[model samples]
Target chain A: MHLLVCGGTGCRASASDSIVESLKQELENKGLSDEVQVIMTGCFGFCEKGPIVKVLPDNTFYVEVKHEDAVEIVDEHVIKGRQVKRLLYQDPEKKQSISDSKHMDFYKKQIRIALRNCGFIDPENVDEYIGRDGYMALGKCINEMTPQDVIKEIKDSGLRGRGGGGFPTGLKWEIASKNNADQKYVVCNADEGDPGAFMDRSILEGDPHAVLEAMAICGYATNASKGLIYIRAEYPLAIKRLKIAIDQAREYGLLGKNIFGSDFEFDVELRYGAGAFVCGEETALIHSMEGLRGEPTIKPPYPAEKGYLGKPTNVNNVETFANIPVIINKGANWFNKIGTEKSKGTKVFALAGKINNVGLIEVPMGTTLREVIFEIGGGIKDGKKFKAVQTGGPSGGCLTEKHLDTPIDFDNLIAAGSMMGSGGMIVMDEDDCMVSVAKFYLDFTVEESCGKCSPCRIGNKRLYELLDQITQGKATMDDLQRLRNMCEVIKDTSLCGLGQTSPNPILSTLDNFWDEYVAHIKDHKCPAGQCKDLMKYVVIEENCVGCTACVRVCPVGAISGEKKQPHYIDPSNCIKCGACIERCKFDAIIVK
Target chain B: MSHIKVKIKEKDLNTIKQICKSFNNEPKELINVLHKTQEHFGYLPAEIQEVVAQELNVPVAKVYGVVTFYSFFTMLPKGKHPVSICTGTACYVRGADNVLQEFKRQLGIEVGETTEDGEFSLSCLRCVGACGLAPVVLVGDKTYGRVAPDGVKAIIDEYKK
Candidate 1:
């Protein structure tokens, strides 16, 4: 039996390492060490119920497996051949134990095109990657197909860039291929700047070779001998794995000069990105790789025409590049058969926030938001009412309940006042104030604005201040009008994609949650009760136990009362930190 | 970014020179040079920026511009153990703001500020891609997941020793 434990960042943070160790030790203690091997693989995308351990042969999937339960897992599941009933993933709605992962609702709908290799293979081992027909696509491209042939196959595949822009990947390569440059470049944009997204990072950590292979294929098509992966410095594990994968690929003669023994020469190098969100833009990414400020330039001389030392460059995000090898191997017709006519293949999303199943998921392009959220995501957490689903990071907008039935393709998302940003689908509940959510995104944009463009730099800050004012219940009706007008100005006049789409959060939120904005403005109240300034902590006189827990917990000494008596909170002194509410044993304190 | 220059030891300056040289003193490799310099020294003060500029043959102002532009490069020295709260959308929606407030209340320092004893410095980062464990706090390399407001003090106490 093979034990596959999730070594993804999410599971690793939750003591997955110790679980791995204990499981290994348990196997030894039970004298099943020779029979069973524990392998740490990439993210399973079921992060909500991690640290996941899947027992192979049977594929008995376990969720929330603790180290202490390792002994029980070994004893019950391994030696006796009896499944650990308790450790098996218990269906949240059905309340039934799911023995196999394939039967789970989360996995049933997922096509797993981009994430096919993720959670299945040990990312570090090249042989393991090769065993699964890893480098065959690159081999086929270099040996059999011409540069135009490869581009034609990609164009026929109908694969658009997975990196938010939704530009045709094939068309991008064709543009760069057409450009006559002595030293062209292929850039893998691993710099995933979307706030809630992890698909790229997980892809790199789980299946680094796929990205490397795709980059080489891209190099062969673009006639570029050099490639650069501009990855975020925050992703240490992904960076380390890519380094290992590159070294291994070079050793196998799959990466360096004359790859697969063909005349095509392509080698990749790593470039680190400092915490700049603008670098996700292709031009900004190139400039950042060139060791300059990550500010975007005009697109007339797009990265295809001139990029990375004035060379024709083809830049594709990690997830976009990840789909390349699959499309090549499966053929464009087979790949294009899935998803909508416009959007081919599947899109991987980092589903998070108020959703019950908060994890990474990849579904077909035509998959409805309702299907993704209700069926696959297991609906909202804590049985809360769904409010909005924020996509496209700072640049994308929010989708309301009305748009849930809409198919989640690139065009569909954009039509719903939101773009398919690097696939960060953050579901918000009724408790999440729409106005506050807009302010949250504006805060991010205001800080991340490169300050090169006046509209994005100054206009975004002004918009942020307006949102802040609305959230704080300090904005008048005129301010709301200004907020609308400002969003248009920023969207229209911004220099690059960053400035162009920075106002999307405000525009999208303003469009869908008009009532919430009106509440904050007219009623002077935050409908969701999230705006701290509008919220007042009230003492529930009936429910107060007066245990002094609130008094002791209050940071500013806002709560005061004699022992065993109802405590009164000083409204003036209350910072609304919620410490008193958290410490109230009798639920004495409530936000009003 | 800080105009106030601090004195750098001879050993550290030599290391900075070596870092710049390792990148072939290329002006385009300024970000890489800064990354290595920051990795060596906990922060990039003005003195080290000056040394890097001289080595790379770029203007000191340009080096400072590059350093300030990237949030990863710190001008102020981080405390012995730096604590970073993820303000990513996933973490933000899941009461990460409350947890950050608790950290600020306990540490008595704003984000990007260090404690007086230099035990811990606080900062905020975008998604670290661990949204499964929303509200993640990183004390140096150690990641604390699902951190709540009440758990902030306890997490800080873990590093106090």
Candidate 2:
């Protein structure tokens, strides 16, 4: 039986590397090292229960496997062919252990298109990638099909850009092809700057060769000889894996001159994005690649006509590119039949924040939020009520329980007041404050604002100040009106996509959770109890035994009372550190 | 943006020149050059920026603009063990703010400030892509996952030696 261990960043952080080392060492000790080959692969998307180890042939899937469990895994599972009962994924609801992951509902509703080879193949080994028809599409495009035919195949596939904007990918390639420039460029936008989104990073980390191969295919279709992957510097692991994949592709003559023994040459270079959120925009990305400040320019001269040193360029998101090879391999008719009428394929979502199954998931276009959250995601964490789910990161808005049944797609999300951003589906529960959540997004947009335009740079800052006032319980209803008006103006006048969608969080929250904002404004009370400025740390008379624990624990000396008597927390001096609450045995100190 | 600079020794100047030369001193390689220089030196001070500007044949103001534009480049030097707390949306919702507040309380330093002893410097990052461990902390190259406000002291106490 073969062992596949998750080497994704999430698993790596939990010392999945040591788990592999111990597994290999233990296997050697048992003289079964050759018999049982341990392969370190990419993310399985079930990151909540990582580092995951899947035993092949029998299909025994293990979750949260520790390094010390290596001996048991090798001794019990691999040796005697008996599955490790405890290591198997225990269903949170039924509390029954699931041996084969194929039966789990987590993997059932999900249809992985872009993430087809992610958890299945070893990212470092090019042979494994090729074994699964990796570069067959590239060869087919170069030899069997013409550029026009290839573009037509993509167009017929009904694939749209997965990077927030659902622009037609084939139309973009056709435009770049028609530009007739002396030099053209194919850019793979791996700069996933969305705060909670990591699907792009996971794709690059798990299947780096897929992106490289797709970039080559894009280069052939667009007549671009050079490709640049503008990746985020924050993703060091993705960058490392991409570098390895590029080197391996070059060694195998898949990326270098005359790829697949054809004249259609394509090579990729890595351009590091040094923490600029605006760089995710096509214009800003091209400027950053030219070693300039990542500022967005007007869009009439889109990147298709002028980009990357003033040459014709086609920029596609990483997930979008990861879908190209699949669409090329499977006919457009086959791929288009899966999703909704408009959106044609599965989208990878980094499902996180107050969710039980906080992991990466890829589901088809028409999959409702209720299905993704309740079924695939295993519902909200700690049995909390599902408050809202934030998709498309800062650019996208907060989708509430009412919209959970809405089918998730590019058009559906936009119609529901949110757009399909880089697919960062952050589920927020009742404990999370909507007013504070809006303030959080406003804060991010204010910091990330490029200061190029007045509306986005200054108006966003003013909006943040307004949010601050609301959260601090100092805002009037007039300030709330101003916040709404400002969000509209910024969206209408942003020079780039960053400023345009920056106010989405505010607009979305105001649209869905208007009561939360009103509570923070009118009553000067935060319904979620998240606004510390409005909270009062009160000592309950009966529970407070005046044990002096809270008084001693209060760092600001806010609590004072007689020993064995009830204590009182002075509101003026209370810092809301919650230290007294932690120290109190009776749980008397409560925030209201 | 802070514009902090230290005295640049002659050998340091040579190192900056060499880094620029390795990338053929291309103006387009400015970001890459700065990344390499910062890897060699702990931080990118004004003196190093000037030397990089002169070698790359770009204005010093341009280098500073590029340096300040990206959050990765820093003008001030970081402590030996720079502690980073992820303040991404995932971590933020999972109570990263309380953990950050706890770190500041224990270290007696603000987000961009270093401890007086220069042992640890605290900073907030967007995300490390480890959403499974929502409130993630990074000390040097080592990653600490699912970090809580109560676990801040034990993490800092690790590098006490």
- Candidate 1 chain A has its poorest 10 consecutive residues by lDDT at A579-588
Candidate 1 on A125-231: residue-level lDDT in tens? 99989999999999898888999999999999999999989999999999999999889999999888889999999999999999999999999999999999999
lDDT of 1 at B38: 90
For candidate 1, write residues B1-161 as lDDT tens digits. 47547988888878998998999999999999999989888789988888999998989999988899999998998989899999999999999999998899899999999999999999999998889889899999899999988888888888887
* lDDT score, candidate 1: 0.91
DockQ of 1: 0.87
Q: Give all candidates' CA lDDT scores.
A: 0.91, 0.91
What's the true lDDT of residue A239 in model 1?
92
What DockQ does predicted model 2 obtain? 0.82
Q: Is the docking of candidate 2 incorrect, acceptable, medium or high quality?
A: high
Where in model 2 is the C-alpha error above 4 Å?
A: B1-5
TM-score of 2: 0.99
Candidate 1 residue-wise lDDT at A236: 94
